[model samples]
Each structure stands twice: as C-alpha cells, then as structure tokens.
Target: MATLGTVTFNNSSATSIFHTSSSLKFSSKPLLLPTRFSPKTPFPLRILRIYALSSNDIKVGTNLEVDGAPWRVLEFLHVKPGKGAAFVRTKMRNYITGNTVEKTFRAGSTIDEANVFKEAKQFTYKDGSQFVFMDLNTFEEIRLNEADVGDKTKWLKEGMDCNLLFWNGKVIDFELPITVQLAVVDVDPGLKGDTVSGGSKPATLDTGAVVNVPLFINIGDQILVDTRTGQYMNRA
Candidate 1:
C-alpha cells in the first residue's frame, strides 16, 4: 500500500528488520508499510535537522530526529550482496505519526539521531495542553504536551508511573509499562462458554481506552493489557 510520509532510506548499509509476523529476521528488500505517518512541519525537511549519523552508528531502538519528527529504529538488516556494495536495511517507526518505514543505506547514507533521554515520572494531571508528571526521586514536576508524548496520552492514568521521553531536555514523549492492569469500566455482560478461545468482546478500560477482551470479561473486572498493542492479555 501507499504510505504518505514514510522515510525512504537512501544508501543504507548492513542492518536487520522484522516482518509482519512481528518476528525478527534479516532481509534486503522493503516490506509492506503502514498507511500513514503523523505530525506535519511547516519548515522544509532539511532545515530543522540534527545529528547526521552513519548507518553503522544506529542500532535497534535508536531514535532519530527526521525532518523535525521523532522516529525509532524497529529492526535492521545488513546485506552483503556480491553484486552490489553492502547496505543496511532498516525499519523505522515515527513517534509522532506512529507510521513505519523501511529504508536502505550504504556508506554515505545518513540519518539524523534524536537527542533524547528518558526519566521515570508519575502522572499527576493535565494542565491545559501540557500533561504534568513528577519525578519519583527528585520530586520535580515536568509539564509537557502533545508535541512531547504523541498519542500515548490517551492511555495516561493519574498516579500511573511512566517514562517521560525528552528531546534536548524538552518533553517529547511518554511510555507506559509494557503490560498494565486496568479496570474494565464498561463491557457487555459475560455469557456462558466465554473462555479465552471462545470469542472476544469490546471493553472500555478505566483509562478511557478500548480493547477486546475474552467473552468472560465483564465490567469491574481488572485485566492486563499489552501496551504496545493495546490488546488484552489476562486477568489482572
């Protein structure tokens, strides 16, 4: 399918990548891509750039500041095809848009790395456009908005602990735990034979997030969900 604003890795070198099955593997060709990317910038692509890093300088989980957007390396593959110069194939997901892209690079190709760091913080509240977080140890309050945390805000729950991602000391994003337990605030009444394999039903979580749970799940039930997919895991 067509992707609106995904990066085209020009001149990539050796790297790795993951396929549709979410399994890690090595490949030299581009794979199917997500539909759309987010966060439009007013300036031209090259103007607000930073950190022109080489192909070898990045690894899985490296963040890049691409055209004023935050992108993370999901996977990469290094190819040494005899017919061509070695190249690195990599998959990138934009933090702002949540879109994934595949790019190839050789020795000269470069990507801009994002200067970011993460801090442990507790969710306090939202003040205007900014969300408030307090450092557990330092007890210092950090205020950040959409430009910082992206879409993760929807899952934010008061008193929940999370990792606040900062770029140049500015709030850029936040991450919840890998798996979190949330109370089911709304869901259809469970029926018989609603075991894990039977079927699934939509449930509204306490955080205002909706996820599919097994037929046995009911309102007031606490369930564990994988934050990465927002999918139901098991009973809390």
Candidate 2:
C-alpha cells in the first residue's frame, strides 16, 4: 500500500483501491513524524510558516510552524464574548509529546505549530533507568528514560500498550492506558458489622497500586481502577 498526501492505497495488487481525501483539500492534517524543536521554548509562540498552508491564512487542522516546530490543532472555537477583542480558543495536541494543551489566540492571530512526532509502541520491560518498548507495527525496540515517562511510569505494566512521542527521532514523552485492572494481592480482613458504618479500607493490588475498597472486600479479589483519576472501580 502507498500513501500520498491524505490518500492511502489499500492493496497495490488489487484492482480496486480506496482513496480517502480531505473534505477541505487545503487543510493539512498533522503528521506523526520526528521534529527538531527543543523543549526550552516558551508556549503561545507565534507561528511563522506552515508546510500545508497554500496562502498566509491559518485554518483549523492545519500544521503551523512555531519555534521551528509543528503542532496540530485538535479543536478551535471562535469566541466574541460580548466584549473585548474576539479570540480563538484552541485545543492543540503536541505531535511529539502527545500532550494536549489549550490556548487562546487573538482573532486573526497566527502561530506556528511545533514539529512533533508520535508512534504506537507496546510496553516490553523496564531497565534500571529506562522503560523498554517495542513497536508492534515495526517490530523495532526503543528505550525511553524515566524523565520521558514522567508520572505515567507508576501505572505502566508489562505487555501494556503505550504511545511513544518523539522529537528528532528521540523519545521525549509517552502515554499509558487510562485505566488498568489488577488483582488484590493482600488486604486486611474486614470486621463484622463494618458494613453498617459505610467504612472503607485500603487494599494493595497485585500491581502495587493502592485502592480504597469496600470493607467487605478481602484478599484475592480483583478490582478495576481509573488510572487517570486514581479512583477505584467496581470489582472485576
């Protein structure tokens, strides 16, 4: 299969091929490719140029050049707000960091998108200072440092799925699944009549994540948890 711009080829050998084109032909969708931007640049910087823009005007979903990088606009809303200068409320996802950030732009204001890249990888195992992951599609293994994982490392488990963010082909960030279920390895036995008071107790899961479970729950129970909120879900 071959890809050209927004179109992709399903089967080169097959006589019939599907072509998916953008409704707004001029709008450029962001690409998950390596970029060359440093992390020291300030946010809300002006966009100087865009590879997809035909003219000088900025359009939603169009990649903008900012701080010598590219960024994709996930959403954009124009607001008048009854008074003051009109502005655009934009939710942009960093292509390299896989991080979504919100910013307000003055109406008619232009800025560059950071040139970032992303790739889907499967969690393999952890080394001393790095977490290893293998690209399922590419079968290529990559190692990311602890700093790149940030706070998401606590929730990562073996054979989990994760997204690797890259800049200039170097991993800079990653994202983990929002929730994971683990078995309760140990918990204090609940006392009789504890249910009447609506009491809760702390339990340790097999993954070592602590959850507040109902007093009736005992060791060897499985539970679901929301990693994003770090809250307990129903028994698994």
Candidate 3:
C-alpha cells in the first residue's frame, strides 16, 4: 500500500512520467495519460514516409508528393462509413501539368508530403530565352528559361508581382493574378444603339492575347481580364 504522507511512483519504462501522487487531496481523480509521443522514427519507417500520410492528417493548401511530382490540395472532405472504415476525399491540383485529381484515402493511410517552396517575385525583363525575376523579400534575381516557366510565361509583365513555385529547389510553376488590366490594341468599333448583351467581338490586347469582349469594348480601352481563362471580366 502507498504511504498517505508521500507519493509513490511507478518505475515501468513502458509508461510515461506524467503522474499525480495517490496521497493528494484529489485522490479520486484518474491518472492522465499523454495522447501522443515524439519518438525517434526507425530507418525503414523513414523510407515509408516518403509518399504516405494518414487521411485525418491531411490539410487543404498543403502539397502532397504523388508519383514524382508535387500536387497541391484544393479541397478535402472526411467521410465516415456505417459499414466500413473512415476515409478522406481530396481534390488536388497538379503543380507540373496544372491538372486536377480527385483521390480517396483510408483513415490510417499515409501519403508523402511534397517539398515545395513559394516566393513572392517581381517580373523583370526577358533575355534571349530566359525570363528574369527578382525576389521581393531578398531582391535576388532568378532567371528561368522557357521550359521552366511553361505557358505561364505569357502571363508575366515587367515589374508585375508573381508567385513563383519551386519544387525541391527547381523552378516548376507560377501563378498569375486572377484579373489583370490590359489595354486593347485593336478592335472593331461598335455602332450606336448596339447595346445587345449577347453581342461579342474579338479584341487583341497589348500583350497579344486575343479575347472575345462585348461589343462596347473598343480600342485603347483598359479592361480587366481573367488570366486563368483569358476572358474579359470588366472595364478597368
């Protein structure tokens, strides 16, 4: 029996050290156990962490390593089955191809986390085949070639802000502003009383991207265009 005046400790190594004395005034309270522990992972376990993750541990806006590339999670939902185990449903976008994927994972499943970094960069002048960008926080210049930028190069403008994505220290992708203001370099003039909402005409922007704008849009007019779809959004 434990003495009433002093605390007795259990020396078992399998348990944690967090405990309360049985002689304390609140002796009726149960002992508290830790929910999780930070233990050193084994070598084999480390290799398994390369591309696996528990369904409950996934979060939106996080990068997951699938196959040889990184994919960014756009949405996630947790589902519980009455007859089976719980699972997670996720909608992820490929950082390399700009494609989307819908995946499901069991409650205890694991997936690898992608090693990705993002930097706020300002677009600079383009060289022979390379586009230059300056890090906004460090002012360091980085030059990426056509292949590194993919189709995103068409969206860049000098001195414009861009979000640069790096996968394992290699330039991979870039995200453009949702809406950009551009002047129409060429467009056919619309007639008076041509206020039809269904009317449309092709207009060429200063950047050379041709878009179908409403009849009212004219040459030299500055308008907002969505970069994702290359569509006119509104007048700037």
Candidate 4:
C-alpha cells in the first residue's frame, strides 16, 4: 500500500511539474525538453515541415523538382510485376529547356514538389528580340527574351492570350493555345484540278508560321492550325 501511494505521488508530482506555466509556454527559441522524462513524454512544441511527394500520389500534370530543375509530368504509369517490387514510370518535360525525358521511381519513393504557377497574359507586341506580354487584369508588362520564346515565336500573334509559367516568382516558360486561327499571307494559287484530299502546299501565315495546307487553300484564306503539331486542321 505504501509503495502504491509513493508511485501515485510521483506521477502526480511529474504531472504538476510538466504542466507549470513556464514549462507550458511556447517560445521562438529552440525548445529542448527534459530528458529525464519518460521516452513517451509529449512535446510542448509542434514543428511543421514540408515532406516530399510520394510516388503513389503522382498523376498526369504533376509538377516535380528534380536536380534543382522544375519538371512537369506529361505521363505516368504505375507498374506492378509478380517478380519484383512495384514502380512508377513517368514521362516528364523540363520547364526551362523544354526537353522531355523518361524517369522511374520506386513505388513508395518520395519526390520534391515544384512550386510552379501560371499567369494569364496577352502577347502585345515584339520590341526588337524581346516579346512583350501584358496582364489584362493588371495591365502590367512583362518582356521575355528571344530564346525564352523559342519556336513558339512562330505562332505568336498580337492580342493572343497565353499562360506564362512561373517558378519561384520568375517566369520559366509559357504555353500557347492548342489551336489557333491564322490567315494565309502567302501561298501559290491552287491548280484547277486540286481536291481537298490531294497534295499539300506550304502556306505562310500572318504570324510567319509556315504550314502545309490542302492544295485548295489559297492566300487570304483563314485556316485552323494545331499549335502543338504545327498541322493545318481546316479552313477557319
């Protein structure tokens, strides 16, 4: 009975000591708890941290940070075999260089998540080699270098709305609409016998983008183009 009472007293004493105002108060400084307490003692401070993304959570359009570079998941497949462990196979594109690569990760592995965002901007004009875009809501102007515009320059036209990809608050890349309607600025006249399914002829659009259109297409004709593949869809 005495030993039972002693144990109860000690437990109550510990509770009182741990719950004191000074011990319970939080501070911005490093918090070190009393090691004398039991291994299961509750910590007075809670720390929040950012954990990497799990492979099982991956999906199409997922953004990741690899080797200090930003990548977007173009495609992903979760594969499981009878002989070995499961894994995820992914096709990702680098935001900066516009290069695509295949990557594999263990089923339960973790990957860093990239902080990327997009802003809507309108292509206002080209000042020398720099392309200028304006935020329609804010009217703020942003100029991108020629190299940053890359091959997309061929499809850009004034007043075209675009999505500018930003990482760490800086613009890294941009996306154009999948399809655009452009007028043919130059093309040879179609022969009399030309059919819609017949031979294709090269036609330059007002934006300087050259695409092969049906032989029936003529200068001043409006055509729909797939910006992703640079193919002519049909007359607009």
Candidate 5:
C-alpha cells in the first residue's frame, strides 16, 4: 500500500516545491500581464444664466424681480430719439400688493426675479386686529395682520375672493377685485336734470369707502363701484 501526504500551498512551500521541480523546469520566471485603461464617463453640460440687458430691452408682460419684489410687466416703451442714452418707460404691478407703479430702467438692464409665492383666498372676517382668509382650494384659513392687508381693508368684504402674496412664507400684501358692490350709506341728494351734465356727487358706502357717484344717486341705494378708480357703477 502507498502512503499519501498532505500538501500546503504557501509562498515558502511553493518556493521549496519549485526548487524540487528545478530538475524538471528550465526557468523560474513569472509571466507578465497587460495593464487595463478605463475611460472616464462624460459629464452633462450645465446651463449658465444670461442677464445681458439694454435700455430698449423692456417688454410688456415681462416678469421682473426688482427691489427684492416680483413685479409683472403691465406696460413698457423705449424712448430713443436724437438724445442721450435711451431710457425705458415701464408700468409694473407689484405681485404682492397688486399695486401698479411707473418706473424707468436702463435701456439694457438685467434684474432678478422676485421670489414670491401667491395664492387665491376668500376673505372671511376680521378678528380684532387680524384679517382672516380661507384658501379657495384647500379651505384652509389664515390670519393676516393689519399691516399686511394695508389699504386693501377697504375693499375686503366677507366672501370676496382675493390674492394673497407672501414673501418667504410671510404674508405681505393682498390683491382685491377691481370692482365690488357696496351699499350707499350717505350721499348728496340727487338733483333732477343733473344727469344731463354728467355731474358726480360724493357718496359714502356701507364699507366706509368713498366714491364719486352719479348726481342721481341717493342714500340707502345699493351701487356697484370700481374699487380701482373709486368711481361708482350702476345701482345694484
């Protein structure tokens, strides 16, 4: 019977085995392998912001970020006729206040867009010094301070829809409807034949808002008024 011995595969044992196999092998050289080259993945191209502007660059309906507020382009025109540098005439609406203002921008100019958030809500009621509004979509109610409501308080009526503008999650201003119906509380008695001359009379509404009504308007009459121009509309 032949006896078998266990063999271990180690560096020193391999060297000893190689030495014992020297008689059978001619050389003890190691084989060389080729090196690998990995190609890098290409990256996506990034888009750069463009802010090059000129005095003649003002366009109607252009959204502008100015003075840290977002404004909508209401009207704009470029003036450049046999003069110095051209100037841009613009009328913009404050996104938060719903107020319109006229401003001039350099013909070629770039401005940042005001980062503001806005939503439509229904005017609910006033709680002491705070005015409350409910979201039209979610029915969620929010309280706003008197400062945020500003002059809009005159136009705010229960159940009226308005736009609430926010800056960094803080209520800033409100946008009221252009026209609203209000009951006349007091007014100069209308004089007959005054309508022929298209005369106007000062009238006080139930909401405490004053408007110029037609000469025929009288107290206790319900009238529609243009909130923007403070002019009276037809009787309600």
Candidate 6:
C-alpha cells in the first residue's frame, strides 16, 4: 500500500508532508490556517486552545482564569522552603465582581491564561439607566447597565475616552482615566479667612459627582479629580 506523509495543522500554522517510493518531499514553509476552527474540523483539532502558564510565570497584571472566573493578578510571591517544593502565592482580583482572593499554586503547575483585553471607548450619553459608549476602533455603540458602570458613573462625561475590559470578547468592566477635570457646579461660598489648608467643603461637579475640595474652591471653578478615590486633586 502507498501512504502520504503525516499532515499536521492547528489554528495558527500547519505543515504537510508528501511521501513516494522514490523520495520524501519536505516543505519547511508554515501553512497559514484560520484563527478559529470549524465545527466540521477533525475532533482532535476542532477545539480552541487556551494558553497554559506555569506558576512561575505569574506576575502583577497577569490575567488568569480560575474557578471559571477571570482574575487579574495584583501581587505574587515565590516561596521555596528548606525541604519542600517551591510554590507561588498570589493575590488576584476578579474582573467582574471586583473581589480579591489569595491563592497558592505549586511550582511548575499549569494555569489557564484568561483571554482578557481592553478596547478604547468614548462615552456618548445615557439612555435611561444604561450608559452608551462608542468603540473608538469599530464605532459600535456598547450599552452597559447601571450596575456595570457602578460608582464610575459619576465620572462619566460625554466625549470622555475610557477603556472597556473584555473577557472572551464580552465586556467585563470599564476604566476611566486616573484623573479628570470638571467644573464645580455647586459649593458653599468661602469665608474671608478661607485658605487652601484652612478647611474643606463638598463640591458638586458638573457631572453630578460630589467631592471634598479645599475651601478656596468655588462654583464654576475647574478642578481636577482622582477617579480612583473620587477626591479633588487640584485646580485644573
């Protein structure tokens, strides 16, 4: 009987070998394959692959999938005892729930790398309770509910650029710029003795977020705010 040389393929690349009675043909060029597999593909190659990472590969900002959830590594430490196998200790935060958890893994253990990515989006407006964002690249409007926006809703302003976090091609969360400048819409009048360090007052921003500002800050003043802590930074 006659046989054709082995053929191997995957989502990224493929190779084919042809064999005959006279000689063997070898092609070193990598064959281009689709990024995705079709349902009709062979059972062995039909499934998509999720990259595996060694415990030693974990580092801050690394995204991982654990217990069926996507988590970002906030901190990691390597421990090697006197007479035991090495291990990794990690603190991870869930992308969806914003919860932090401590997990340990044996050295050289395999971990699933989460398919997480971010897309640039611009805040367009609010439709009822949903906030609409337009993808900078695709120009597609993505509507996120109130809960998804959470406390960040206060910092959202029309035309503001933000980063939308995606896991498995779906939006999991969004992040605003670390600092934003907004006009103070309302605040109590400052006294004659008021100074930058004299006292503080609650100031309502044009976007409806209230933050504590130095007594010297007044209505219609443009002030910079820290989005992470919702605190007034300084005059813009």
Query: For residues 1-236, what per-residue lDDT tens digits would candidate 6 score against the true structure?
Result: 22222323332212111123545443565433345434432112322335667889999999998988999999999999999899999999999899999999999877777877677889999999999998665566889999999988888899999988877546898889999999999999877768835679899999999999899888889999999898888898
lDDT of each: 0.72, 0.63, 0.72, 0.80, 0.68, 0.79
> Candidate 4's error at 44, in angstroms?
37
Error of 4 at 110 (Å): 2.2
Model 3: per-residue lDDT, tens digit, 1-236? Answer: 32122223223311222244655343333333322212321101111112345568888988888777799999999999899888999999998788998998888665667757666788888999998988765567888888877766655678788877777545678778888888899999977766666788999888778889989888999988888898889888
Candidate ranking under TM-score, highest first, comes to: 6, 4, 3, 1, 5, 2
Instruction: Flag regions of model 6 displaced more than 4 Å.
Output: 1-49
Local error of candidate 2 at residue 93 (angstroms): 8.7
What would the per-residue lDDT of candidate 1 be over residues 42-108, giving only the tens digit for each residue?
1112211234687877789988777677889999888888896888888999775678999777855
lDDT for each residue of candidate 5 in 1-236, tens digit (9 for 90 to 100): 32222222333224422345546543344322232222220111122122323436557766666776767888988888697877788899986777899998766654544445467888988999999898766666888888777776776789898877655345666678888988888988888788787888788888788888888889998888787777777998
Stretches of candidate 2 off by over 4 Å are 1-65, 69-78, 81-84, 89-103, 115-117, 192-197
Report the C-alpha lDDT of model 4 over 1-236, residue by residue, as the tens digit.
Answer: 11111111123223322345654644444333322323332211222222367899999999988888999999999999998999999999999888999999999876767767777899999999899998887677889999999999999999999999877446999999999999999999998779746799899999899999999989999999999999999898
Candidate 3: misplaced stretches above 4 Å? 1-53, 57-60, 75-77, 97-102, 136-138, 196-198
Provide the TM-score for each candidate, comma-separated: 0.66, 0.60, 0.67, 0.75, 0.61, 0.76
| Global lDDT of model 6 | 0.79
Best by TM-score: 6
* Candidate 3 global lDDT: 0.72
Scored against the true structure, residue 185 in model 2 reaches a CA lDDT of: 81
